[model samples]
Target: MTITRRNLGLLGAAGAAMLAMPSVVRAQAPRVVRYTHFQPGRLDQPKHAAALAFKSTLEGLTGGRMRVDIFPAGQIGPAPQVMEQLRLGSLEMAVVHDGGISGTYAPYQVFSLPFIWENQAIAWKVLDGAFGAEMAEDMRRRANIRLLGHADNGVRHFTNSKRPIVTPDDMRGLKIRVQPAPVFVKLVESLGASPSAIDWGELPAALAQGTVDGQENGVTNILAASLYQHQKHITLNGHVYSLHAYLMSDRFFNRLGNEEKAAVLQATEIAKVIHRGMTTAQDANAEPILKEKGMTVQRLTAPQIDAFRQKAQPAVRSWLEAEIGREWVEKLLSATRAATAG
Candidate 1:
């Protein structure tokens, strides 16, 4: 065991190798992101399609330094549970509907202020601008979730088994199922329908079992969930321009290197565009899609839609002003006006 010059040199080389091995292993190991959304994993489904694009694009961008494992159709859990996981850093990312986002950040419900966005373009302008940035920052501060981007959840319209809702009066005395968010409940109540708060997982069963006569959703969701099979009628009132928010856990995002973060942000923008395009196409062709599915599709006149808006907007705005704050409600209104003008 006497140390010679050659033996000492060999020991030093082995020691250096041992020290470098850990760093090499760490560099070679890919960071796995658990991404989830509440849509079927089929390519036809918007969320899944976007998710696939994100996975491929991000992996390519990072040259395999990152790997995304997607859990579509709520494979891990329902929206609320998935969101909780995201907040706690058990999950890395999610594309969640506004209703689910509202559960974590109540200010998100301001987007649900019934008939706020006249069209998708205006909605996008508002969401991609300063107001959306401000809200994203606030959400990060409050909920520890980073808003990557906002995409269309589709323009929500009313669907019923009993009758076609041509006006606010037609919605009266109907039991309409809505997402489990207070703003939706208020919106339905304001329009005179009895709103039943149901989780997305339970909605199809609720319609089939007559737990609720009808429900409201966008074209993409109707096609995704097959809600059109149960609801014989749909009113394309475009009452609410819904949103699917791309979210990442602040804990996970902050841990990434600058290049990785940039790749993630760029990949999310790509996915957001795909999501919005698919959903927007479905919304634009809603009438034909529903009619082809054997559902009675009702397209309301601007005046008819105006009547519903006048009735429901004020009521929901008042309720929201009390719930979140008048400042948020007013901020959205002002943004909408500016976006519309621009």
Candidate 2:
């Protein structure tokens, strides 16, 4: 049909509207981030809670210019996979533990050593101080991840279906599931238990089927995974004071504007406090809860814990020195001692 003047005017308007839409959409779009972790999305769980805190704070601080989408409970895959995603900038951020991060950066195993800290106060002192800053920078440079803060995995303890662990001698022949990390393998073996390197996803099944008679983890982890249903006894040997590394993809971090980077760091600091408090409270309150669930929970006396520490320390330290360099080991120990000194 022949076009009229009025029809030509209408067609011109429609074409202009279409041409302008792309710029409008780009102007209104928010910068999105994908954050993930292995923990379940329970309000009481530290990682999930912390992620929520970050999401809320970041959106508020950025006035909705940034959006953080959280995926919990291995929604993006296990810790190692998530870690790789973070490295490749496929994932924006994650709260990964020593077990997950160590696979990429071997020196992270330094934190997995047995009895490194006598208590949380000293551990926090070192980690929140300059030493921790140095370590974070080292990770940023070497591993392509930015360490935002350190949260707790709680101090790991031993639990077994076989018997209560009073002494290192009691661990003999017991097949104990451990994170698939050499430091953990060495820690368990040095204490005389046969270490079965199992992925966290498979641990509950491993315990339930007696594929492994025992495992060592924080009380929160034991409770969260319902390992108590399978394991009858728990020994709070407190061998390894584990940590959660709150990390961001270095690629994503480097691309952020100055104000956006500042807001992200501030939000993480806020989250670090919330996360650490939750885990600390869990460690304090878990014993009674475990016992009420009908599992025998034993809190090791000072000497008993010391005994296990003595047994595990030499072999594990030697391994660390050999594997990660004596210089780094000594440097960490020096920092710990300085933190502990009055």
Candidate 3:
């Protein structure tokens, strides 16, 4: 029973009634939800705030029927391992970056395609529109997981201590730190950098000890992690838009009474709003704060950015086709273009 947008309209009416069953009502009276994130208690850490907000909203929505137990700072496992735990039903819920777990659901990589989103507003519209909902349905079918929705982490920009990366030629020969994921490594390598796979937990120390000369991330992340202390310049390459997911195990969700299930989904949606608001707000305020902390933020112009896309797109798109399917990549690109225009 694969879900599609058309079929969902029919099922939704029938589903709504069952979603409020008495057994569900009873079960959720003492339901427990386990949530986790790698970010600690920093005001700039949106995931941390999303966890707290979800707990407060879910319990309130359920009239104290559900209790949320959240683990912060990667207590259970690293970023890549969490999705497997969710699929096996060992973990209840988690907020994770789409890039880290796209191996399990290759279609999710559609969001991580470099230079796809022009800005957060356009990205937000697509994620909140039918496309995001459709993607969530697809994930449920493929990976037995529910994408609660997209959460913003800001635009990912390049940072380097070696030299200013104004163009693709500048990225050459610089060994940059990359997430322990193939797609990210491929993106950096496509741009001519020596991509080194690194865990998020060790990035701070890696930077501090000069293990890696540079990396790419959002302004909010750079400031929050104090990466400015290691990397001398921030090039607003804005290469990729950073997106995280508020994910739940479909198996676990399916086992719940309808009302309990809805409660959980509703809570996840609330967290999405919290996550987006905090992260975007952080990015909005980061320029001044980053300047105060002595980090130089450089914005690239059209000609320079065109040079980057031309150099990197062929390799990145080719890799995408190899990993997934050519047809799928074409579909995603088409949808993104449509999303962009609208």
Candidate 4:
């Protein structure tokens, strides 16, 4: 309670000691990132592969000042919940599919317009260009989530236990499981299949239990979830060029230091490349992969694919225009056309 010369001297000495150990005084706890994805944490899974690359590259870039903790296969929660966590900054990052994103940013469903992309190359060009940048900015503003980059979810194709879908007519009367997105629902309906809105996690079970006769997904997902075990046939319709969005919480990102931010952005781009490459390879070899899995694989000719496009494209596009507005619909159409032309 009394000021003493001895106490004053001791306090001064402590201050001097602290000053002498600058590194100890200046050291801060590492920033932790809680990253998540829907796929299992296996090297074979594109999402997990990309996630590992991201974690290593980011930590290395930041000299361990930043740490990433990955939660794969919905360990944190389901897609909708995970997305909400990201938006609220409770989760730092996610590599979410387009269907998962649609619940948060409805306009993202514009990408669900069937058969728009001629090939993965055309899709990549549009996603890596101004159109993608614009969409990212808009998503940041609307959802409080930053879209770092886009990767392939795979070019979606139809698989069924009932029949090989060679034409739109062949799709009739079968119940197909689709992501719980309106565009996908409309797409299946347009092809004359009865669509059952099923969660991705429930898809294999749905097919196995005969809750749905078939479902559509990319080759990467089919193998990742082993849906091929349930579905007997796959048609290489390539109906939709699906996407996996590299997303970060804007709240978390905005608080980062300049150098940390740079590292994250660069690391995300690297992950995006890995994710895209792995998924694209699987999609390119869909027939062989599905056949190896002991499923019947049907490869469509150009005319057959065109028939699918004619049937489903307009229906899905119309639904998208109605839900998200024609502006985004047209924007995607124009972007794809430009990408194809180039």
Candidate 5:
């Protein structure tokens, strides 16, 4: 074989061209966020708003190198199934309710304490405070995921096929649907009511068939699910300040570079603002919408709410101190107090 200078020169040009290319070209494949939510997508749905923001902000911040495949209306199984997928690294992200987290992340149940936060402002103050950061760190330490941020969910209220609920005794003899969490079970049990456990996806049909008299959900959820059609009255117990957790699997988060990780985290922080704004802004119009549906809305006085909370809180507080650490509970209360003072 004869060696040729021209062939050698061509090979040298090819090597130089290869060296000019980037070592790691921006990831073009869709990042695939198997995100899930329990709400149907509509013009006014807050979860949808948040999900869209998650998709947009994440993709936008990454310059379209990353993409999210959102699953709304329980398209990717139910909330529990999605969380399990998250644990196994099959799913990338989710904004689940604390009740859903209670199954795997027990500390998250702290947010589900019945009749806790006085209003949205108080809830936001505490959730966005230093204590909230501590709780988020705890989840990362124990639960194999990073706490992204919190999305807003209005107060959990009671709606039943029966009459108005003015007191805890009024909840008696009713088989109300509660979350699968123990706190919810205890909360309903404290009222002498038969607590029925059901997932959100199945609640509507159950209510329609009388399998359950009613379910506790935020006013936004009640209106979204059109639960008014099944139940005659809505008692605004505001028993629990509903919470939506923004979560990211540590498995995925750990794989990213420092700047990419910061982008994801910062995006989540801004999402909390979008989440709260979307929810609180919607509250003023929710009551009128509920009334127009012909379902009566019950607003209890401060004394009435205090009466129920006094009984319910002790059970919840005792249960928490036993299940989670007393120190953690104290921190939560301290955080609440600090936020109120501010």
Candidate 6:
């Protein structure tokens, strides 16, 4: 076959075009993040809303080069399985609670220690500062996870169908559902309640079926899960200033370029603020909402709260020290004092 100069030039151009196609396709393909959580994927839910905000900001910052796919309401699996996935690098990210991680990363249990923080002001100061950095480093070393930031789970409070729980004695004879953690079990038992270890996924059913008379959780959680429907009374005991952890796979994080890493971290901070704001707003507005839903919401005065704190704190702190160590407990107490002192 005879080839002309024009034919040869066309062939070269076609070869060059084919060679460039792969790079074009690679540039267009977005990096996907599988972000999972165990909360309702609704705008009204703080965690879910924050997840959306994170997705938007990260994508925007990356110029659509990054995309996040959110899985909420335990769609992937339970907390333990999801956390395990993150550890194994099978999952990209998650917003798990302190109780969920305490078993694997024992230091996270510090947040679960009842009556540890006097109020949210003191708690945020510690969590958003040096203590938080230390915990983040510990988590990176031990759990192979990067702590992006802390979001609110809000201060856990007591809710029951039986009666108002103003004092420790009022908790007596009540079958209280606690997280399947020794710390929580001890906390409830110390308050004179019979503690039943129930999974959060099963809690609403347990409360509805009278398998347990009541349970403890943050107002946002109770509201999100609609526990107010089953529980008649709520006491703002503010037992534990619990938090939700925003974590990324350290392996994944380390592999990212500097710009990508910055986008992820900055997106996390923005999302953290959004999450905390929603949670705090919900907490502040909870009593009225609960009342509107035909449930009795009781606000404990300083003396009332102090009385329960006096009875419960020492015992729970001792339990925590025994479970984790005296060192962590002492460090936490010192940090708490330093963070809150005038």
Better of 4 and 5 by lDDT: 4
Alpha-carbon deviation at 194 in model 6, angstroms? 1.1
Residue 327, candidate 2: how far off, in angstroms?
A: 2.0
List model 3 lDDT by residue over 1-342, tens digit each: 789998998789778868768777786477778888877765458888888888988888778777889898789898668988888888889888766668678877756578877778888877887677888898888888878878876778788887777878888888799877787888999888899988888898988888888998876667667788998877877678888888898888887777877877787888888888888876676667667888776778978887877876777888888887787677667767887887
Quantify all predictions' global Cα lDDT against the true fold: 0.93, 0.89, 0.80, 0.91, 0.80, 0.88
The residue pairs in collision within model 4 are none
**Candidate 3, which segments miss by more than 4 Å at Cα?**
1-29
In the range 1-342, model 2's lDDT, one tens digit per residue, is 999999999999999999999999998798998988878899978889999999999999999999999999889988888888888888999999898898888888888778888888899998888888988899888889999989999879899998887889999999999998999999999988899999998999999888999999997788778888999998888899989999999999999999999999999999999988988887887788789878898888999988998889999999999998987788789999898885
TM-score of each: 0.95, 0.95, 0.87, 0.94, 0.90, 0.94
Off by over 4 Å in 5: 1-30
Instruction: Tell me how far the alpha carbon of residue 216 in candidate 2 is from the true structure, in angstroms, after superposition.
Output: 0.5
lDDT by residue (tens digit), candidate 4, 114-225: 8888888898899999999999999999999999999999999899987777989999999999999888989999999899999988888888888989999999999998
Score candidate 1 by TM-score against the native: 0.95
Query: Residue 185 in candidate 3 has what lDDT?
Result: 86
Model 6 clashing-pair count: 0
Instruction: Flag the better candidate by TM-score, 2 or 5.
Output: 2
Q: Between the candidate structures 1 and 6, which one is better when assessed by TM-score?
A: 1
Model 4 local distance difference test score:
0.91
| Best-fitting candidate, scored by lDDT | 1
Highest TM-score: give the candidate number: 1
Model 4 ranges with Cα > 4 A deviation: 1-4, 11-27
lDDT of 5 by residue, 1-342 (tens): 675999889889988878755543433455556677767766478888778877788788887666778778878787777777777777788888878888888888777677767888888888877888888888887777778788777778888998899898888899999878888998888878899888887788999999988788877788778788899988877888888888888798888778678778777777678777877765655667778989888888999998889878888888888898688788888888887788
CA error at residue 23 for candidate 3, angstroms: 15
